[model samples]
Target chain A: MIINVRELLPFLIPLIIFQLLLMISALTMIVKQRRFKYLNRVAWIIIVVVFNIVGPVLYFVMERK
Target chain B: MNQISALFKKEAVESIRNFKLFLLLAVFIIIGIISPLTAYLMPDIMAMVMKDAGIKFELPVVTAVDSYVQFFGNMNQLGLPILVIVTGSILTNEFSRNTLINLLTKGLKRHNVMLVKFLYTILMWTVVYVFGAVTAYLYTIYYWENELENILAAFGLTWLYGIFLISVIMMASAIFRTSFLGVLFTVLGVVIIMIIASIYPMTAEYLPQYLLTSNMSLLTGETGMSDVMPAVLITAGASILIFLLSIVTFNKAVM
Candidate 1:
């Protein structure tokens, strides 16, 4: 299975981690009451998942408010 | 005009007052000096270690290009990270400490604040880069004679690529309210650029990462100026765009 998904090695794990990080950040924002809008958070979640390091880092910076 | 000059003077004074920056410059200068020195001494160093371990080894002839390659490798990984740690909190730190209030209240526009910050970062970067380059260049030429070709193009591309990295750090600093976030974002940008560039061989020459890779070829005339011009232009252009974007977004964001 490792070799079966060999070509996908880089993307899968990174993407998963990125997703988790995004979720945690978004939930933190929600709990803090800084963000009350769901659509904006969801849009950011999608972006963070797709662009790997750049997206997540950007989210970590840009969407903090 | 006075605002611009005042801002420049203020940043210059701030950088000088921060004694830690002097230490950082010393470290980078040492790295530059030691890199060429190491490449020159690797054979003896390796032989001593290997002999102590009951092993024999033969080392290949090292050239000036090897020293230059060492410079690129070290600067990209170590020196750059130090830069991030040092300058990632420029405006952010000001905001956190409320120091920016005085400056802004003195009639300095928000956009001008961002521009000055970026300019000062670039200015510091240029000073450090020239110090490192001069150290390595003098050392390399003193020991080994390199057959010169497009040396100007080679050096320019390498430095311009470095400018690209500085721009990323500045933009990330603007976007992130904290220093750690700025470092994270800038590093993330580099990694993503490398990964995407790796997907296609044709893109390798144009990627910001290629600046270090093609240094020797560009210097030796093995590659022409036309090959490197695109990459330099792209890196420089992207840097300007990122800086402008950061200024616009930062100006809009309510602090």
Candidate 2:
């Protein structure tokens, strides 16, 4: 049941990069905006950066001005 | 036509500036990428888990079609709601910002405004949809090489459902002055359709909701064109009717 990391790198790398990009963008916007209707900016930033893919997506869809 | 074009430009710019386009494409592309990757890695992941539990089982060889099934499943469960949330505020945002009143007083036709919004939202959906579909197609090709059966029909049915969903959202936003109510109505509309589909097995054949649920089967050839054509027609017809209704309601709605 050993999986080769090399064979999977092509897919894994892109997925990780896309996820990180989303996370970073969400965090940066949270810091810069500093205002949200529902949650405080600090909570929003923590949620966006900490939960990986779903976190950033939740922030964008349900949050953000 | 000129008025419609002008409003469409406005809608396009608003979508871009608000980051809806970027967020949607990013989410969909991630769905596209992860679906196939999950399918490709399923066997190894399961084997490792089973080894730890001292259990053994035979797993079916995953194919390109399996990836597509996964892709469509994600589209149904995750992608559709994301689509709803992104476009749910189309009209309500204008209402809240008082832009709708400004534009109405400036001689913008109500029906034209609704039509333009519908058109632009669909256009964005199409672009991101293609991006996601192509990404999934390329990765599936790389991992498991094979041509999918009824590929066009599968995509077409799902694409029609997306259009239907957007129309429903548009109608909801048009009728409701608040973005939250718009989203609520849209979700309620979908839930009612789903509930009816489940309650009456006979009517499921004609329900548009069937298209979303059965897309994977169509790709796998377990479902035929004959099975889906009725649902497809009903979906397309319902969408058009909803669109027309939205226009009429929007015209009369107090800004």
Return the top candidate by lDDT. Answer: 2
Candidate 1 residue runs with Cα over 4 Å from true position: A1-65, B49-58
Model 2 vs. true fold: TM: 0.94
Quick one: best TM-score, which candidate? Answer: 2
Question: Across residues A1-65, which tens digit of lDDT does each residue of candidate 2 receive?
Answer: 57899988988898888888888888887778755877888888788777886788778766653
The local distance difference test score of each candidate is 0.68, 0.82
Per-candidate DockQ vs. reference: 0.02, 0.64
Q: Model 2, DockQ value?
A: 0.64
Per-model RMSD to reference: 13.9, 1.7
Query: Per-residue lDDT for B166-195 in model 1, tens only?
Result: 677767766675565655676677757786
Candidate 2 deviant stretches above 4 angstroms: A62-65, B52-54
